[model samples]
Structures are given as C-alpha cells and as structure tokens.
Target: MPAGIRLFLGYAIAILVLIGLSLRFVIDQAISMPVSPLGVVVMALLAYTIFTTTLVLQRKEAARGLAIGLASLTIPGVPLAWFTFAAGPLGIVLAGLTALLAVALLRGLTGQRTREWLSEP
Candidate 1:
C-alpha cells in the first residue's frame, strides 16, 4: 500500500481500537480515571501515533534510533515501573504494550531488505 494510505488506515485503526477498548472498559467496569491517569494514556497514544506515522513515511533511518530509544525509556519501562511499584492499572500497562507493538511493526517495515532495495533499482 501507498505510505500515505497505510498511515491513514493505521491511524484510523489505532484510534478506533483505542476508543472502543477505552469505552468498553469504562462502561463495563464502571471505572473512573483521574485526570492524570487519563492524561498519561492520551499522551502515550499521541506519541505512538506520531512515531508510527513518521516511520511509515519512509523516514525510518532518521527516526528508528530515536523511536527505539523513546520506547526503551517510556513504553514498557514506565508502565511496568508504575504497575509494579506505584499500583498503576493493568489497563495502562496493556495500552503501553499495544503502543510498543505498533512501533515495532512500523520499525520492521523499514528493514535492511527495504533499504537495499531502495539502494538498488
């Protein structure tokens, strides 16, 4: 698929999934999140969305290292830390894992094979 189309579709899918899951959790569990917790979720989603779309646009060489570094520092790291030490919700940890997977897929799409292909014909 074209990069633009893929990116748009990825965004659409991610947003829909996030919204549906969040609503289901809230409605089914009668869960009420504090503003800070909500803010963290929103920030993570926004960061992952930007990073995924950027990777999809063939800017991987520039972004790959940075994205990896960010993921290592934030995604699993912070969520796991919170879940273990600070009593963060399991839902937050799961959301972070999803974001990490999206970024990993985006990175994989720009592998050495594609780089070699671009370097050739």
Candidate 2:
C-alpha cells in the first residue's frame, strides 16, 4: 500500500478508537440527561470515517477524495486542541502532533507517487 494510504488508515484507526471510548461516555451522559446534538454528530463522523477507511484500504479510485476530505476534517482538531490547552499540558502536545500529522497526511495524499499508486487497477 502507498505510504499515504497507510497514514490515512493509521489516523482513521486512531480516531475509531477514540470515538469508541467517547461513545461510552456519551452513552452514560444520555442515560442521565438529554442526549446532546454533539453526540449525534460524533456518531455520524464515526460512521463516515469507517466507510472512508474501508474504501481507502480497498484502493477504490473514489477513496482518494474521501481520504483527502477526512484528513482535511482533522485539521480543525489542531486548533481545538490548542484552545483547550488550559485543560493540561497534554493539549499542547496533542495540538502539535495533530498538526504535524495533518500536514503530513495532506502532503502524502497529494504526492505524485500516491496519486499514481491509487490510479492503478
């Protein structure tokens, strides 16, 4: 597989794990209080991420754009991490690492090698 695809898959898997963890919390919150709209949105994102990851892994031509879009979506998380840095030092590290990964993913996805590799049958 192309490095770009690997990068995307790794990121997607990490997101899936995080979402799974958060879903537990969301479920607990729902049990005690009114369900938040954010929970619904997160669920939708989780489903989309899983779909995109599967297509990308299968090397579908359409998945290139889907992977790019998914990577683009993660860019906002960097600033969100930074803004929430007051919570802990981990926020700073998270923001920096997320930014680095986002940039790398964008570059790798758009690179010539990745483009050619994905274009193959």
Candidate 3:
C-alpha cells in the first residue's frame, strides 16, 4: 500500500524476472556474451542487493536514500538502453524516454544537495 513497499516489491520482482530471462537466454542458449553468464547473474544480484539496502535506507534517510537507490539502478541503465535502438522505434523511444525521465527525476530529487556538493569553497 505504501510507496516504499511498492517500490521494494517492484525492484524484487524486476530482479527475479531478469534472472529468469537471463536463464533462458544466457544459461540455456549457446550464444556468447561480453560478460560470462555467471558474471551477469552476479551483477544482477549485486544490483538487487543495493536496491534492497536502499529500501531500508529509504525508511531511515528519506529522499536521499531513494535518490541513491534510483541512481545506482538507472544511471548505468541509461547508456545500456541505447542498445535498444537496434530493436526498432519502440525500443529506442521507450528507452530514450525512460532514461530522460530517470535523469529528470534524479535531478528533481537531489537538486539542492547536488548544487551544494558542486559548490566551490
């Protein structure tokens, strides 16, 4: 019911789905990857760990925690989203727009902290 729980569940569900898909494509298939299948699984697990950690942090730290969690997930994701262009227009636009939204949301969430961090003495 609460947004934080909903977000945690969303992250958990997404990670599980990613592992399932990776099992189908990476583990089951003979195709090669830039990273090993085990490596891919490990990274996904690592990311999931961060998300779960952030979920706890959110309860304690509020916007700062949510910003960190979302950043860890989406910042790297944005660049990788470009690969979607090869899949066609929908993939390109969807990824592009989602990345934009993520960036804007991150900026909105951390604007003052970011400005302060960047300020010189």
Task: Give the top-scoring candidate (lDDT).
Answer: 2
What TM-score quantifies how close candidate 2 is to the native fold? 0.84
- Candidate 2, RMSD to the unseen true structure: 2.4
Give the per-residue lDDT digits (tens) of candidate 3, residues 1-121: 2343444445556656766666655544435656776767656675755665454444443434444464456656666676756567766776786687566645544556443432332
| Per-candidate clashes, comma-separated | 0, 0, 0
lDDT of 2: 0.85
Candidate number achieving the greatest TM-score relative to the actual structure: 2
How many pairs of residues in model 3 come into backbone collision?
A: 0
Clashes of 1: 0
- Model 1 Cα shift for residue 39 (angstroms): 2.5
Alpha-carbon TM-score of each model against the true structure: 0.35, 0.84, 0.46
Off by over 4 Å in 3: 1-5, 24-37, 40-47, 50-67, 100-121
Candidate 1: global Cα-lDDT? 0.51
lDDT against the true structure, per candidate, is 0.51, 0.85, 0.55
Worst 10 residues of 2 by lDDT: 112-121
lDDT by residue for model 2 (2-121), tens: 788789889999889989888888888778777688788888889889998877767777788888998998799898988888588888999999899999999999988778767635
Candidate 2 Cα errors over 4 Å, as ranges: 32-35, 86-92
